[model samples]
Target chain A: MEASIRTGEKETGRKKVLISALLFMGLGHLLHLKQYLKGLFYAACEVLLLVFLPKIITGIGNLRTLGEAQPHLPIRERANSMFMLIDGIILLAVIFIFIIIYIISVRSALAAYDQTSSAGAKKTKQGLNKAFPILGLAPGVGLVVFFVIVPLIFSASVAFTNYSSPGHIPPNNTVDWVGFDNFVTLFGGDATWAGALGRVALWTVVWAALATATCYFGGMLMAVVLKESNLRIAPLFRMVFILPYAVPSVISMLVWQNLLNGTFGTLNRTLRTLGLISSPIPWLGDPWLAKFMVVLINLWAGFPYFMLLTLGSMTAIAQDIYEAALIDGANKFQVFRKVTFPIVLYQTAPLIIMSFTHNINNFGAIFFLTGGGPMVKDSTLTSAGGTDILVTWIYKLTVNLLKYNYASVLAVMIFVVLAPLAIINLRRTRSFREGEL
Target chain B: MQPKTTKVNIYTIIVLLFLTVSSLLVLYPLVYVVSAAFSPGNSIASLNIIPFGDGTTFKHFDHLFKNTNYLIWFRNTFVIAAATSICTVFIASLSAYVFSRFRFTLKKPMMMAMLILQIFPSFVGMVAIYVLLLRIGGLDTLWGLVLVYLAGNTPYNTWMVKSYLDTIPRSLDEAAIIDGASHFTTYLRIILPVAKPILIFLAIASFTAPWMDFIFPKLVLRSAHKQTLALGLFSFVTDKKNEFTNFAAGSLLVALPFILFFLASQKLLIESLGFSTVKE
Candidate 1:
């Protein structure tokens, strides 16, 4: 009788495992169907892979043959085709895994549906209880896993490889694992890496410090001036100042570019008309002046944000603080210096840091205004202007020069430079993470 | 005591007057551009604050329309911007809801990763994006540009929408669930109504970005027909025989929609700004 009981217990345990797996599989299938209705491409891919894997492989092989015979194909073209084949296969594999997971989930759900317990509707309850966590997290995790985590891994890995060139090299030329060679070359003073690094560091500091300070002070001033109880036409003034922020930076930069033209630019014309100069100011020509102009233009673009931030922060400040300051025999300047500035600064410090980081990589303003022009003399770097920030310089190197390794190296460097600042900003601005939910 | 109060008020007035005057310096370029847009001749070379030569003609606008691909550009800009804003808001809102309401294992790390990724500056990945798009047959298409914009904006918009969602209480969700309503129903009925202010703000913000974006359009949409407003304007102004007046006219035209939108939504926009700050 004891032997019989042991055999029976083992049989029930096997049944339970089978039942749970089957239920999970059924639920996953159902979810995939729902995802199909939602137009998820990956879901379709999942369905295709489950329905027919051999056909897909055959199709890819045919495409590869076609790719080989294409006329005037670059060496990298062949490599790209091969990588595409690999990527397609990987995608198919992922789809298969997804389908398998889906099937398991459905089976579990079905098992729960079938089981009987002292609790009425025990099977459905158990299935649902098992499925809830997976149902909640599967899609979200899938997306994060696929897009964010995968791309990050790929990019980080690329940093270690000599995958910069477009020409195809045999056996995974897409990512030849050079193993720290890229990093070493970057830090070893080959390819002007050190000079570029120093320049990036110097400009980052200067740009951040100046941009943040100017915008902060300027914005506070505007907010204060606009907030005066006696000031009429405050809305008009606010609108005018806020216009820079409202208008797109590209438009602003383009307009400014024209205005700064040496020959017929309104700015030069105005300066010339005022007898301030005999010739047009080479605003885009001179390195220092160009940098200065870019900063000034950025200031114009940036101040409105600070103005808005300061205005909002100011309104939040209690009116009692100012009144108390006044009662304590503090003058207007004193009240503002002690009460207003400190509160605004403390509130906006994180935002200021963010703005500073943004300026470090503000390619749009620089790219449009000068295209990082007045190209540095005698530099092998094509399309690099003296004013080129690391971001634009990377673009110049990779796109214009096709120096993928250098660009990747530079990109990794940029991240390294800004990572500390970002961490600090993220820590300080709890709202930033909280808002991400 | 009366004299002292009067003196303080006078000082305030004086300071206010000074600021008002200096503010004109900021307004001068915009005013100049507007004046230039209207001026009939190539009088932009002059520093004349007033409309100096052949004042007030619609010829520049006429020239801008007739000579350039202004209409195509306008259409492309509208299509791209509208499509990007809609897609971005839709995707961002859904993801944000998930992020906001769902307590999953990967949530914190995912959010942190997005923050870190954003810090790297998108331009660093431009080449990679370009190559990726080219491989996928997305290069030179408006949809390609839109996708790029969508991917680029997801992190920020998700953060914004999530923050907006945070202002709402979880009790609403609990009540909905107790009523046998699903998560979707709670999101649609409870969260969305409260999120209108942020939605409008984000819509306006998202709309403005693509309309003004030049670089990606320039890089990806190399065909003249696919040019956006910024690219179109850049090429127009820089093309041989600089059409200063026409450029100004095109700029003014481009600025109109945004300015009008801002005016219409000024109250809500300001409120949203305040909301973001307070929440932060």
Candidate 2:
């Protein structure tokens, strides 16, 4: 009786597998026919080979030798060609693997559908069913891998290569694989390298620190005022304060630029009219003042966001905490210090860190406001201003100087510097997942 | 008791007075710009509160219209922003729905990967993007700028939508399934309707992202005709010295719709944010 019951179950499983296999096979055939009409006959041939004829092709073609044969190619050229060849091979491998998986799936489906009496066929069909969703994730995963991940890998690789000029182009442009030559140059007590990097780093750290703190406090003040119970025009204040955020940064920067214009700006003119100063301040021309002005403008652009965030977080706190404090004879300031400050800090620590990182790499504000301005003479640092941050410096290197390889190196360095701060922020925000999921 | 009540009233009055004064300081610059946008012969250098100094006129607006490619920039911005908002909300919500509803094996890893990617400042890969886009013939195109913005905004939008979806009960999905509704149909008929507030919030947020973003547009849209409002306004002011008034007027034109949108949707915005940050 037990054997009969088991045989019945096996028959049912076999039937299910057989149906799925036939369906997949039919779909594959349709796709092949469609491809043929689209003139992808070679690709279709490859697909069929992957699906039905598994052993015809043994090894994938090497892409490197396809380049024009030159025995005396430059090291940089050869290295570049080799990298491309490896990349092409990897791409081919991916296509090959995909076709193989599709073929195996369709074939398993077909076999399971055809062999209704085989219990093993039923097991294979169940396994494929379990693996199907992973197949579905292929497109998104493929996009990120090819576009973001692969490029990142290449950029990181370029940091170790001496591939800067026409000397690095393939054939003639063979890159000598100099492991960490660029990094060593950057860190090896070379005055030029050390000086440029040191200056940019100093400015970035100072600017980020000041921007983050000022914005945080400014935003907190706005939030506290808006949250006041007796504040009658709170909504208007919110709108006014938040207007800076609503406007694009470029526009805000331009408007401020006009306001700070040495000859015609409202700010300078107003100061003069008020008899505060006899002359216009060279807001963008002077190095120290330029840095200060940029930070102040960033403060304007950045504070509103933090204000909105703090306001949102503030409303989330339980009213009873404040109420309980009031009932215990605590004044408004005491209740705020005990309840409001800690709650906002704890809840918004992650956001504050994010704000810091953002300010650190803030390219747009710097680019628009000053263009890292008042270019210094006798500086080997191409396109760097007295106030140039690392990012703008990298932009200057690549765009202005056409030093793609070195710029790529700097880009990697920037990522290395910023990624740790990002990780810490991520961990803090991860707790919010509990609130979400 | 009466005397105490009077004292409390005075305290409230003083606080209100202080707030009113602070509000004036905050609002003055914006109001000054708006009035200047309408005021003719308005020495932009003047900090005059009253419009009586030079009298009000629409000449700056007219100047803005004639002197710049204002209409083209406005059209491009509208098209890009509208399309980006639609595309972002649709793709993000679809992905968010999958993450929120499904019990897939790779879901956790996928979410974690997205989160990690979000933390990396996108400028880190700016050079790579520029090279890639150049190769693909996407440079100097609004479409290229759109793609860049879309890629940058997706992870955040996805998380936002997913958080919204989490607030919805699983029982609703179960009920739909029991009634023989497919997952797609269940999402369309049941979940989307209920998730309207979030959908609108995401739409507004997405729209504002491309609308307010200047960096990618500055990088990608090189041609004047293809320039979005932000880039167009920047070039209009900086490329010429005398168009500063026109720049102010153009800024007003650009800021108006967003300000209106925010004002109109304040309640929904607050609700969506409140729901998103609400503790489980």
Candidate 3:
């Protein structure tokens, strides 16, 4: 680069060579176009990137133990004692980012060389024009990868390790890879885990399906009744219904929690005062009632969403379909069954599926209302309450019990169970599938 | 338009009565809570079905205002919610711009990554976030909660907004580029105005998040002073029972703004949901 003659358009062959040489960072600028300073900077970047390669490998290696050995090691021997896992992830992420940077550098340097040779100019400064996308994408992507993706990877890794209660906590205690022991414990005949998993998993499915069904059909029934009866004040009815949905769910649920509280809740107190019952009912402290209350409270918050969704889709259904059905001698019920119901269902099927999935992870309502209540007295479960869904159960396990390994295993299990349903629901929708870009 | 084949009879009367009862049932909680807020007595037991039970007074509201850090919690919630809204909109807009407009090398993979990231529920990564916050000393801080809230919302919001943006004609972008504007300029000037509805919708949706959110804020914020409205109000009832009236009053006060804000944005919110519903 230093001694070469200035290259120009006639050096298209040199530009092609430089483009190919872009694989080695500044080689394009150095050998094809004489730009010594820029070439050296690119070379330094390449060297620095190479320096991060071993760090990535070591990070992956250290992922197995998560640096538990640091606690057992001598003071002088402790390496990355704090945030060994974090350090590893940061190193690996830096390596990943540097690779991307390397690709950009190589491509940009090659473009500069190509333009220098194309325009017969010895120097080219493409300037900040190319920096726009990078600048725009940096903050969003950085925060997402750091805060979201990194934690996800940690969870994924922890799923394979023994980072649970007792002997496996970090810092004071060391956590090591226990292979599929947690999964085995969960899946095997371990009474506490398996019983809890089976019970909660079954309820989760029932809750999700029932929540969606009750909300959905209830909404549909309401819409049909209003549409059929020719209610002039339908908007007013609709407004009243939508109030529960519009209010932030946490406030509504918490309000309901107090309303339904067993001892002194307004419902129990009012009922007792009215001589409806001889004694106060433990509405949330009883298992069956707690489950019923979870669904019932969730319904109060959930049904309106379906009502609106059904109403919107119902508006899209052609009145002509009903007219056609009517002309075919279809009764009112027949018209609804054959015409209105199917069209509404077809349009809102994806949403119904999504709502089910949402209800599965509908953490706030269940967690806030019951805190997964009615702890079973003689059950084989630990940390989980009767009304607890898988999500809240996982929460109790992690935060309350410090069963990180079991929680992570449960997390992975949840991902396995729900991710497919979610992906299928997402892809089944027309809008997303039809979107080309 | 011609025939009235079905006659109204007992079923019609039953239907009307049933509908009225259902509506009343839906309105029951609000009426009861509103009454409790204004109830003269200082306990949940005294919360009668009547609208202004015993006598109407503002003492609970007064207690909430004077004796507690309700204002600080309100201030913190507003600050967090507002910051989250603005940040989510701005960041999601930019990310969605690249996603919608420009085709890059990682475009497909990035899209897939975001989609997959979104599908995996947030609790799967909950522990990692807690650990990360602890390591970075983000625990018990408002900014830390904001950061978490922003990250948690980014993928889904970005994808939703991007799908909406994709519906805009590419010809607009082409014309702007032909007019010698940068891509960012076109995105900022030409595209943003058109995307105003969804942006406002996103802002409102996110603005309401921290106000109502219990779990994440509960996890990230620990101290009394750092508590958001959700956590502070939760603490009132999560323990012993004497603060029931106070909790009801606080919930009423907290919900007043939200109820108003929500009613105002009700149509817009539904419209946005319907719009994003198209994306599954």
RMSD of each: 5.7, 6.4, 4.2
- Candidate 2: where is the Cα deviation over 4 Å? A1-147, A161-178, A376-380, A429-437, B1-25, B28-32, B35-52, B55-57, B239-242
> Which candidate would rank higher by TM-score, 2 or 3?
3
Q: Can you tell me which runs of candidate 1 are displaced by over 4 Å? A: A1-77, A81-120, A123-179, A191-193, A378-382, A429-437, B1-6, B9-17, B41-54, B239-241
What TM-score would each prediction reach against the true structure? 0.82, 0.80, 0.90
Two-chain DockQ for each candidate model:
0.44, 0.36, 0.59
Clashes of 1: 22
lDDT of 2 by residue, B18-85 (tens): 76775665555566567667766534555343533567778878876787688998899888988888
Give residue A108's lDDT in candidate 2 (0 to 100). Answer: 44
Ranking, TM-score, top scorer first: 3, 1, 2
Candidate 3 residue lDDT tens string, A1-437: 63254444346665565565566877776776676666777788888877766876777677545664656676565543225666677667777877787776676666665676557785444434455677778888988898889888778777777777776666665567678888888886586678888888899999999899999988888877766777678667777787887777877887788788887788887787789998989989999999998888788888888777777667666678878888899998888888888878877887787788788889987988888887885233487888998899888888888888788887787788887886785676444577752
Query: Which 10 consecutive residues of model 2 chain A have the lowest summed lDDT?
Result: A32-41
Best by DockQ: 3
For model 1, residues A1-437, the per-residue Cα lDDT tens digits are 99788668656654654554344333222342222222233345445665776866665563334134333556545445334433443354465556655554445433433343223343232333323444544544454344343344445545665655555333224444467887787675465765655665577668667877887788878888778544557777778777887777776787788778777777787777689898778998897898898888877877887888888888889999989999999987798889988987787776777787887777787888888776665245445667777777776776676666666777777777789987885776556544643
